[model samples]
Target: MPFVDLETNLPASRFSEDFLKKLASTTAAALGKPVDRMVVLVKPDLPLFIFGSSAPCVVLSVAGIGVTDTAEKNRDNSATIFPFLTKELGLSEDRIVIRFSPLEPWQVGKNGTVVTFL
Candidate 1:
């Protein structure tokens, strides 16, 4: 599974499920994975404080089996994710932070069992 958990301090805007769907599709294409397996969680309007200042900031974590397997792949993923944050979320690229966690199938769980077994 390709799972993205995105948390933003910025207040919610006119975001809809359509935006998430689009993001999933973009992620799937970038990772060369099936679009139907993408899962994105967006949490906005959260009270986030950094450097004693209240500004628009986003912290996103992406975890999957093979998405972040290599440096080159990470670069490829960022190329697609960064621009979308600026254009769709209105956050400056610098204010956005993305962390990639590449998981082995056994490290993930699914339906009360390990993903690898499935």
Candidate 2:
């Protein structure tokens, strides 16, 4: 399972839905998983502040199996995601913090069954 959840103080309308679609494809390529299996979520319009500043701060949590295996992988994923945020969200690169989390196979359930695909 690959999930990219974004929590931002900015307006939801400021983002492009197409970015999630593209992120699904890019994340699939990075994880060697099928694009259909990815889950992308966006929770904007939240009351968030970073470093005591309410300007525009985005906290991104990217969870997946076999995707965040190393720091190098995290850096690579950041490279892949950063440009998109700059272009779509119009935020500076330094305003975002991306965290990578491990997603175990047994944690996912689909269609009344637990599926294990790592």
lDDT per residue as tens, model 2, 1-118: 7888889998877768677788677767766779898888889899988866889989988888778879998888888888777777788988888889977778777777666742
Number of backbone collisions per candidate: 0, 0
lDDT (10s digit) by residue, model 1, range 1-118: 8998888876567458888888888778878889898888888898876545568888878888977888999999999988887888877887888899899999988899999899
Instruction: Assess the local accuracy of residue 18 in candidate 1 as a C-alpha lDDT between 0 and 100.
Output: 85
Error of 1 at 108 (Å): 1.6
My TM-score estimates for the predictions, one after another, are 0.88, 0.86
Pick the lDDT winner.
1
Q: The CA-based lDDT of model 2 is what?
A: 0.81
